[model samples]
Target: MHIPFFRSFSRIREPSIAPEPAAEPAPRLGGQLERALGRTVALLQYTADSHDALDDVFTEIDGRSRTVIEELDTMRTTMEQSRQSAQDKAQASIDRLSALSQEAIDSLTQLSADLDKRMERIGAVMETIERSSSELSLLAINSGIQAAHGGEAGRAFGVLATRMRNLAERSSLDARQVAKLLDFSPFRASFTQFNTTLAHSIGDADRRISGAFHSMSASQIDMAARMDEIEAHTRAIPDMLANARDAIERGRRVLEIAQAGCAEMQNACHGPRALAAAAQRIGAPTASGVSVLDSVRGRGVLRVAIEPRAWGMSFRARGASQPRGLDIDLAQAFARRLGVAVEFVERPWLECPWLLMAGADAGAAADVMWSALVPAPIFHRVAFSDPYVHFRYVLVRRQGEARFTDIGSLAGHTLGAMPDPAVPDLLHAHGVRWGRDSLQAGVPRLKNLLIFPSLTEVFDALCAGRVDALLLEQTMAGWVCAAPDSPWSGRLEMQAAAPSDPVFHYTVGVCDDSAADTMREELNAFINGLHSVPDYGQLLKRWHIEPAQVQPTLQ
Candidate 1:
């Protein structure tokens, strides 16, 4: 009834191997060893699972980090482009403004010279009038004295003398009024002051914009360097992931060995739960923060609001719902820059501002408004990009009609004018006196003013002989005169509203509620990028309007 453990070992002699009762202790020790091996196997398994879990976490982190890195690279590229564009735009603007300033100065100088010549001509006319009036007055006085001496025979002479004196006096008054029209000192002073102020302001703006561009370029360079460092670090995520995977592999090998030995160590006393906790504590990585751009990149769509108004900046082609215009081009460009698809929503011109301001609770909204000719007061409600186009008033007349020589000629003739904010100023600048009355409360008053609902109506009136001439902006006038199908085509010609006039600027609008500050900066950056070429002029030309350079687009 005795069995000896390790009977095959040479250390124990076969004769000494006896059926002793000590076999009980041998089995007990073997059972404890098997339990201990089982516990070791469980611990190893927990460690392997922890390593695998940690590796999976790291793999996810690596993928997300790479996505972030890619987005950062895109941002860096955008910044670089924007910086370069800003610099180019600033330089171009400086050159253009300088040239324009010089052009303005030259024009004013020429105008001054012309005025001097006209004043000389007026002086000669006044001298001739004075000589004629004095001779007539003397002849009348001599005739009157002779008439008094001749009594009844001179009655007819007396009557003729009185008429001659009256005619001479009237001619002298007319000459004095004409002389009053020769005052050019005020215009010269105003031109000088405007030129000096504009030059100084332009110089200051040039310096500021130049400095800003330089600063932005430097910032972009620094950001690019920082991005490079971050990218280098992010690129190591794969290796880190590999190491984690290798750790899991080694842990798996160890677990396999322990699993094989589990039956031999029955006396194992450690708990598997404690082992798992330890493994988790040692294997897990610290939490990585979320990336902002990554969170938003999945949308891949940009929403835009556009007004498809015909014959203006934006319009839809006939038979096609798709929009075409400067705004559409700009919006498409912006979408390309963002690497997104455009979703253009049509809205009324008056509702564009509201679309940007409205929230989803109000139904729907757009990020920004495009192709708006905003006024100064509206800036309080939203932000505006720099002007991309400009327009000025022009007086259009029928060809072969008596050419308008002066502002006085407009007094008694029927003048067709549109109800625009800039029309009154244009009229006033031409020295054409007007008044505001209850007949048309908000419209300018002229001697023979004809109010119209629209510029098209004004042009139609001129062509139909309902009005003597049409008063409209140069852009619209150009459109009308150039249109082959228009009634005024071949019959109308454009003239300046005044020798000089101010221009109306057109700009884009960003809503106050839609990250307006950032949107303004981004929009401005995009606009600055466009200044590398004369796209503004090209766009106007494509639309059959005058180039911005000739009309001079303002910021």
Candidate 2:
């Protein structure tokens, strides 16, 4: 797709004097018109493709975000389940231990009471036996005294008394022995033994209790492990729930984003529909005219083009292919914006009078020329529009090259420059050693004047390692070196001039002709509208054009 370098402005015709009706009968919309329609179609297709790609990338990002959130939710739920299970198992163990401890205490208390009662019974029996023995011994002593008084007959009685005494003595002895045997005095020892047995029994019971403790501990450990296992298994429930919920949330967000993007796409689609309607208003076509729209229901053609005045430029890396300048891009943008077909025309400069006049000689000349123009002299029969951009200029050099220490160092190398009015006066004042013109002067001189139509081309040529030094603007210089992360950026290099002077303004001009009156007015009005309007400022700022007044965004 070749783009026009310039619009032909040959043989100026006199202005139309009177109000006249449209002269020509509209042809069955010609090839030019069809070409315009075709461009619109191509643009719409491009927009659709771009939007589809963006939507796909967005979907991928959304999916990844959704997955991460879902996993996080699952982790949280799993942690909660494990904590709760552990607490429950600990509580149950405490309850069981409490019951076992109480039961052991009760058994020990009952055994202690039984031992006390048995000791009391043994003491009572021993007391009763001792009393009986004492009574028998006293009776025997009294009987023996009576027998002694009765002499011979008393002898028998005394014998019997003696026998009785002996018997009583034996009985007393046996009773004493029985009393000793029953001697509840040792009941203390029996009680002590009972206490010892009770202690032993209590100890056995305590040992049993200790055994229960071990069992309880083991049970608690097993229960804990079981609880942990349950927790591990149950974790899936909450985790699944949380994951589902998070995934649903992510899905919802993606849907929202999709809706927004869809709305943009829909709006973009509407442009072509409106354009078609406008074309019809001007008597172009209808829905019946387009077969594609009839079947697909995709009416309207969306055409998107950067504004023609945009000065965005791109440069290659340190070593690479020749970077294309902005000339072709600008012309293409204009043609596309106007719904016209695009053509690329190369020219040495925008202001080549011979080039403009040459259209008469060669049928294939420029439709529009996109390049630089300094404040071309007023006498040149060309009237210009207000400047779109203005900037301070600098002398550029290859990166890491020898520095131009003094103005004199610029003498030997070829100097790159665009046509500017103030150059001669500035150069003379600075005593800078430089060139005049190599092509025209044909001077076999050290300084070779290199002319560039626009600084963009110069920077591009710089990237191609074409020129040693060229005049460049600061903002553009920054963009050339900016990394890929930068927006509206490129790659290039520059150096400060030993003497930086008089800034330049960018503008478009047309040869003074009354025949081009209508187009000229349109172009002029577009330029004048830039002053108060903020969007105009936005355009320049977007291009990083300096000397532009910065303003707040429209409400």
Candidate 3:
């Protein structure tokens, strides 16, 4: 009897062991199990990818929120300072205007008092003129009476007295006219009324002006108080943003936990799926074929090919058990997504792609090459994932070397570079020939070109003064010249070849085999997922990769 249930149970008990070759054929249950397992793993991976994207969005939002809060704080501080300065200026203007108004009022009052005193003196002078004219008239009348007593002799005296009397009358008339004209009683009363009205008007004007100033001061105080309230409210916005960031962080932690759970679930299905494949082999040995992804899962290890000396990308520190670099961290992250342990295979950068092309039986075969490899014509057989990081090529030279400015500056200088096809193409484009032994093809060819095997060796050549300058990647140059622990720190400087220098994209390369397409797609998904991850940027920072060296997008 062909018992299908017993066969399934037997396969599950010993998943690692292969089924006997002579075992009787069973149903196509193992093929179905494999398909189901593939679907489950795909769904879990999709979920993880979504989580990564969402986490990245949250992190961006958090960062922007912090920036907004900081800007708001700065705005609030500037507004406060401006407000105080404006208030002080306004207050000073008001005080000055008030003082000027009071001074004008005092001057007008003094002028009014002086005018009243002059009017009184003019009235007294008119009264004295009238009294003198009356006295002259009385003296003339007495002289006329004496002339009547003495006959002919008195005739001349009488004529003189008459003339004197006429003169006195004229004088009296003039004094009377002057007294009428100088009638200070009515004029003084009118002047007093005018002065009183002017004083009253000035007082009223002063009161109104004072009241207006007071009102203005009160409004300013109210406005200042309102502004204070507004500033206080503005100050609280940062705290609100902080709370939102905290919530986002908490959500991110939860998502991380969920992702971990999904990874575990995916790993748990590997055993049963392998056993199902073994059973399927018993039914039809040629029908069930393990994919590269499946093979990696079966072994519970992802072989990551890397160039250990690619500084800032992948390198092992002295006395460290594990390698540390941006590529190293990224490779480990990709391995974690597969629910497998990582096994790093060190190789030269140029030789890394060949390791992926090596067959499964090869000792140094790798599932993916995580070195900072660029897509080139030489590696046509290798499948490259989407770009994860990018950097521009730059010229690195010793400090105070004024001879080098741009790519054209390297014309008369010995330039050092590692073995890269792109390097030669770049040099050729700039009319600079590669190789020390090669004849100068042009007049302004490079003085000499030294090709080293690795980045470390190239850097050593530059440091040892064997090379005049180095054509290097921006991130690597920055790491070697700017890192505090670097021996050449502060002794070297990097300059861009040009403002429009081509950006070099770094991608993961895999063998272009039947199973490699699936692996490449998965690697691309993993790389794309890291775009929003904060740790991706932090990892680069830890490796001394500047933010400017990183590409915001895959392109």
RMSD of each: 36.4, 26.0, 21.2
List residue ranges in candidate 1 displaced over 4 A: 1-307, 310-312, 317-320, 343-348, 359-364, 372-374, 378-380, 397-409, 413-419, 433-468, 483-492, 496-499, 534-536, 548-555
TM-score of each: 0.39, 0.32, 0.46
Q: Rate the local accuracy (lDDT) of all candidates.
A: 0.56, 0.43, 0.63
Worst 10 residues of 3 by lDDT: 278-287
Q: lDDT tens string, model 3, 228-284?
A: 444433433443344345434433433343333233333334554444543232211
Whose lDDT is higher: candidate 2's or candidate 3's? 3
Cand. 1 TM to true fold: 0.39
Which order, best to worst by lDDT?
A: 3, 1, 2
Instruction: Write the residue-wise lDDT of candidate 2 on 1-555 in tens digits.
Output: 211111211222322233234444234334324533433333233333334434443453454345446645655565455555545655655665566566556655765676577666656655654554565566456556665577664656666566666666666666666555554555466567656766675666566656656655665665565454344323223323333443344334333323332232223223444334333322223332343112112322211111122134322233434322332333344444444554433332322321221121213223223444445552143445455456555555666567654334555454555544454445555555332222334233324334444555555555555555665554455444443433224444445443245556655444333322443455456556556767655554453434523331210
How many residue-pair clashes does candidate 2 contain? 18
Tens digits of lDDT, candidate 1, 412-522: 455767534555566676656542221444443443445453345566668876667767656657756776644567988877554346667667776442224555676
Query: How accurate locally is residue 539 in candidate 3, as Cα lDDT from 0 to 100?
Result: 77
